[model samples]
Target: MNVPAPAHLLSLATASPSHSMRQDEVLEAATQLFDGRFPQFERMAPVFKHAGVLTRQLAMPVEWYLQPRTWPERSAVYDEVALDLFCEAARRALDEAGLTGAEIDVIVTVSSTGLSTPSLQARAIARMGFRPDAAGIPVFGLGCAGGATGLGLAARLATAQPGCRVLLVCVELCSVAFRMEDFSKVDIISTAIFGDGAAACVLSTGADGFAAVAGYAEHTWPDTLDIMGWRVRPDGLAVVLARALPPFVRKEIRLAMERMLASQGLTVEDVDRFICHPGGMKVIEAIEGAFGLGQGALDRERDVLADHGNMSSPTVLFALDRIRQAGLPRRSVVTAMGPGFTTSTVTLAA
Candidate 1:
């Protein structure tokens, strides 16, 4: 198969809800909410302290999550916040790219935390003034990897249609998935780290930006579907996080990275920088170990986690924005893991 010319990443932007929660405040809230309810609340509460998250933005106020909410109520909030964030992020991205929504030939929206009928781009079309004929692709279920995956998709689309621009947006309202009724450890851990945010980027075949999509690949482990995902409950979506995540990353991520880079006749040594999803402190460390880097080599990843928490799909894009601001290297690798027990890697060139 012939490879299309790499698509340029013209601009990237991120947005978060107004309400922000400090780590100490989150610990206090978790204690008040889960202390007596969960059997091992005391034993597991410490996870919040070590989550490496200093603060996070929430779609709703912290007090709003204290009350039990039905799925309908949660869905309503998701629709409202998701649209607002998508529009803000998209508009900023378009402005930075010196283009309007109407100039976009394709729109790729990725999310997994909530359900929406018209999809994010569809809902934002009239508000953002995108052309009615623009193609819309809504990708769900990629979980944390959605941002990188969506970027790869948009790049491919732009390459396919030369001179066309593609807009990719990732929005996750992970905070709205909080379950008061579920006393599982996953729920507690998720509450400690998950946040609400959205990120958008413009991609085109033009060479206006510093970064271009070079290559993309993914790896999914068999029989690992239960590792990380949601458990549908009558009240809302419950968190399901398996304990094997860190070890799995250490074991498989390197090999996956080698394969992805080798396909382009490159190797880990050829990568000048690694822009990765900061799943947590431990996950960042694991990635460093996988890449044979120093313990704190992934400072940007840690910084993004500390500032924004884990906003699922949009977290990696936040890291990319920071990397760009610092100054893009000649070659960078963007990777993220998500619910399918899947790892998505995208090689970018400056």
Candidate 2:
């Protein structure tokens, strides 16, 4: 069952169903982490409800990833779990596309939670028996901006080569960095929000398919490093997510969208589909409220969140995959926010 080779595919490739921890499970875990030191759990009640997050998936079992152990133990677990996630996602995506590894030309990998020299891209290729000439490019430190950034790179390559095939893979094992001992508000929020997941897509310039890559634009906001990023310590990853991000999205994203569309000679009004990342409940609300997008602007986003929590780079890809599977209207604008405090938007003429 060969996937009817399309001209280009984005998030429309096949995706595995996301699994999550139950709500009671999260509350219990939060209780154990913050039960005595911080009474902020009650304060976060409304937030949990408002965010509509009942559950979130973990990259590894919480007990396993959060266990304090020697560096070797930690390294071993991270390596094992990250590989598991990468393989699961890669295989499912390939199967959905009805593709074998040999069909891929270039493998573009994206992730923020784990490190690897050969990277998941190489591992996937080697495990799946891909051709040796299949180039592998690993992108790190992009954080949430990775998916759009990967697509942007793919688009550039496809345009330059005029018929190239590229595989874009994103896998984030965020659970590997979970700090259950921390009761900080930001940490709590991150734990409750972030999830483990990966996504894969095949982008081609030669064939025509369900949705096509139209154009992409990226913008970096200055003076916002503290807005969101990681502070690596010997213990684990300490996430710094500012509360002001929601408002920032409302103010800056509109401007960014305008500039991105102008370069392509299009406007928001002309776009028939929106595949923006669900940064969180607030982030999604900020986008919708500011842009005055109709009710359906976030249909895919809501579905993805309910199904997969926040898989960072993979989240938006999952949303776009759902949208693509629905056979959405043509002319779409897909975007995501990442750590550079940067926003990347891609316009797709489906």
Candidate 3:
């Protein structure tokens, strides 16, 4: 395989909806909605407290999630709210990069929460002041891995054409897909961890700003399709989270990463830091164990999870943003596991 052309990340920014709910507030709502029907629900209630999420922002107030909504109704809210986040994150990223929408040559948009006909970039052309000629590469179904993957994609596309600027945007309205009408453990787990948010990254060979993309690779195991993903539901989208995920990650993640890095002519020992998607409290701990780090060593990952829950694809970029603010390491690897039971790793050179 050809090595990707070197490209610098100009800026990274994240945005969230205004409706905030702390764990206690979310617990109260869950109790109200699930207590009467799920007799076993109380036994599983402890997940909220131990989930390590202090608060999360949702596209709509908790009141809206309590009612039943049709697919059309849910998608309407998704289209509206997701686009607003797309614009906000995109604008902030461009401003931080000292560039405007007109300067962008490509838009790589990633999402899977809800369907939109025109996709976000096309819909926002007028509002965002993007050139009608700017090409859009809308990616779907990458789930939580989209941030690193999208960043890698943008870096490649930007460097594909000299002086080209590519803006990568990841938006997920996970809360909008929360459907309690059909009962399942995954639904409850999704409530405990999922949140609505978006993150954007601008990349080019134009100039060094933050870090340059080195390489990106993915590893997927056979017969692991059931680990994590979404299922289409008549109401909206159903969350599919398997209980076996944390253990699976702990067992396989290290070797998987070793292979990925070796393929790039590097080794795990060469990485100064490992920035991983905080899939959950267990998954975070699993990542630490995979790298032989002591428990709770990934404090920043914990902080992002505590603050934002899991915004799926955008979560890793949030971690990356914090890592950049703290100070970039000489060599860092941004990674995440999502649907396809895949682990995607993107190397960054500071």
| Steric collisions counted per model | 0, 3, 0
Clashing pairs in 2: 6-207, 7-207, 7-208
Worst 10 residues of 3 by lDDT: 2-11
Write the residue-wise lDDT of candidate 2 on 1-350 in tens digits: 84333247733342332445865677676667676768877777455556656677775555664455544555565566666666666666667667778877887778887767657666666677678998888888888888888878877766666677777788776666666554578877776777777887777778665667778898988888999878886766677789999999988888888888899898778888678888788888899977888555697798787666777888888888787777767688878889988988877776
- Runs of candidate 2 with Cα error greater than 4 angstroms are 1-7, 10-19, 69-74, 294-296
Model 1 CA lDDT for position 217: 83
CA-lDDT, candidates in order:
0.90, 0.74, 0.90
**lDDT ranking, high to low:** 1, 3, 2
* TM-score against truth, every candidate: 0.98, 0.91, 0.98
Candidate 1: where are CA atoms >4 Å away? Answer: 1-3
Candidate 3 stretches greater than 4 Å from native: 1-5
Q: Which ten residues in a row have the lowest lDDT in candidate 1?
A: 205-214
Tens-digit lDDT string for candidate 3 (239-292): 888999888888999999999999999988899999989989999988898889
